[model samples]
Target: PSVQDCTICMERLSAPSGYKGPQPAVKPDLVGKLVKCGHVFHLHCLVAMYNNGNKDGSLQCPTCKTIYGVKTGTQPPGKMEYHIIPHALPGHSDCKTIRIIYNIPPGVQGPEHPNPGKSFTARGFPRHCYLPDSEKGRKVLKLLLVAWDRRLIFAIGTSSTTGESDTVIWNEIHHKTEFGSNLTGHGYPDINYLDNVLAELAAQGITEESLAQEKD
Candidate 1:
């Protein structure tokens, strides 16, 4: 009798010994069900095969074959991340906000642009760089971001820290600049500046989870 081919696609696995780790024995009823082969193939492997050429239902499985499912192409989900340093001033509620402004075109102000003026509406989680009513904490936050990421720093409110860059008084900077941002329309500052900042965060693997509240 001719040997039957394993439905599971194991061609990708170069080594055959103990292949795909320890896969559970296939169920007897699953035999000849057109299952996918691999070091470790899932039951759903068959679904992909069933729908491979399907326009309406494009999915197939290694076993039981040709599962009817809708075609799903990869799509990018646009998201921005940031940490918030809440109001540094007392009795003031600094609406935590983060913005992602583009260096070029369509400006981030087309109603949906994550501009800093309304930082609260930007993202649900903003990192508190420094605690309110604490001089030491604010200094610490300023130091942390600047020291760790090599990012230039600035701030709004009624204080200043003499970093390599001047402690830009936000209001004064605002009056001088186009957005009254003095720094960049609040936290916006220079387009290149923000782009670099966000890029730095990306490099550090700053994801949605980075916005969690600090436990101090």
Candidate 2:
């Protein structure tokens, strides 16, 4: 049998996984291949990696970052609403605007949260976001809807602005909180915003191609 390195443990596939945690009672040389990326790894190494994570019932290939299953987050219950506005943003005067509203309230953290049983503060409610009503903007809206469904929109964590912990904050995905101008740097007029957001969404395993795959 050909020998290959398990990226997770940095060990040969022919050897037992170098995971120092509790070991699974499987063959030392047993290897498993991820279905989507087709990257192979020692089964024990994969199990160890999964255990180290949030155990969210999803696996990400370390080599290529290809997600195996639906990746959900611990975002608390909230509402996401969007509508077409008649106004045009600064640089996107050619089309109307798409406004997104996210509303999350204060609540006790669940077992999946960082501080379970502790109350979290939702400083902002009904936060408004904006995007141009163009073809690319609409594509971003569709993917944002998917991200909201997966609870990857907001999470309870330390606020970078207020230095307060246990508060509802935006996840890795960025949004245009400013509607008219780019004063806060989160607004429009930036030509790369759409493409940058698409990359961010891809990082979270939410892309148009992935969405189509789910439908199929």
Candidate 3:
């Protein structure tokens, strides 16, 4: 028989590995119970998933609602709910209307490489490169995400292996993420990392229903 897969962690089942996870009391018949784009996972794994999606304290589908977590949209700008709920990106052919919220702590940065701190905090970036939201802008954003992992702010900015920071390029990324033109381009797919994150958000109960209720 084929092994069952865990959708949340994208892992396959096996005899206990040299790690920690509960052995199921019953063979899972998840083939019938699993939801599409959803995963059947251990409670511990589910908690980890929850923590990952709750990065900004808001829980929402990374795929559907464009970009919102457990809160916002439904409620007025100032008011906020105390609890987190499953949320999904609003299903639309166009997700440009969506924007993800990012918190900027006093100290944070991105990965280390030829291009450092590329997609770090949402602030202090120029607006030109960010505009148009093209492949280039997203590439920059991805780089920054990598850089932010390292918390290397000073080392941030797109510098070449030649050891030079491309101010023009860096500033442009800043622009696009912060203030850019209405140039919507499509290079990312629905099954990419962002969408994957959204799927988890959906599991958290941050769906369209939450948005509607929050606005009330």
Candidate 4:
């Protein structure tokens, strides 16, 4: 195969690794291809990439973002509860409401965090998230359940809004938490939220396609 520069270090694939980042002590001078995606990366560069990551026993291809293992999250200990409520939302009065409650407490970072020994704050505990009971909403709910099981819902890191370090934060996937009012920009009457979230889930490699591959 033709040689290409390593994505991590910008060094030629045939040359000795030149990564000056935090990595394992023994750096191997070899280029390896991921079996699933067939994306080539320097062994040492791959080592550094994985080492500097969350180390949740998963590796995503740097080029294509194809996940290798079960992608876990840095979400701190929390509680997630969901149930059907009889109340109707603004846009969908025919269907009931699906109430999801998430409760995360403050705690010290674990091995999966950026700073393992640092203490993180849970700004919001028992956060109430909402969903419609429509067919698309139910499909979104199923994918969300998979995301939660993989710990992809929430993560431990700096808050983007508050700029506070070492705190519980939401990941890329968005949730509609508000019920009746759209005042918080997270309420009902969002006709496209369910489809949008499904797209987000697919971006995170949590779609039905990935699930089918796993089953195979």
Best by lDDT: 2
lDDT digits (tens) for residues 1-216 of candidate 3: 127544444445442222134543334322222234343343444444345431444433323423333331110011111111232222322323223233332223323223344433223322222111334324434443332332211223444433444221221112113222233422222234344433433443444454455459
Clashing pairs in 2: none
Which candidate, 3 or 4, would have the higher lDDT against the true structure?
Answer: 4
Model 4, CA-based lDDT: 0.83
Winner by lDDT between candidate 2 and candidate 1: 2
Of the pair 2 and 3, which is ahead by TM-score? 2
Off by over 4 Å in 4: 1-3, 23-28, 209-216
lDDT of 4 by residue, 166-208 (tens): 8888998999878889997888788888888998897677987
Query: Residue 33 of model 4: what lDDT?
Result: 90
Q: Judged by lDDT against the true structure, how good is candidate 3?
A: 0.32
lDDT of 2 by residue, 36-153 (tens): 7789998888887887766889988999988878888889998999999999998999999999999999999998899999999999798999999999999999999999998898
Q: Looking at candidate 3, what is the lDDT of residue 152?
A: 19
In order, candidate lDDTs are 0.29, 0.89, 0.32, 0.83
TM-score of each model, paired residue for residue? 0.18, 0.87, 0.28, 0.86
Q: Candidates sorted by TM-score, descending order?
A: 2, 4, 3, 1
Best candidate, TM-score: 2
Model 4: lDDT of residue 142: 79
- Candidate 1 stretches greater than 4 Å from native: 10-29, 32-58, 61-67, 78-216
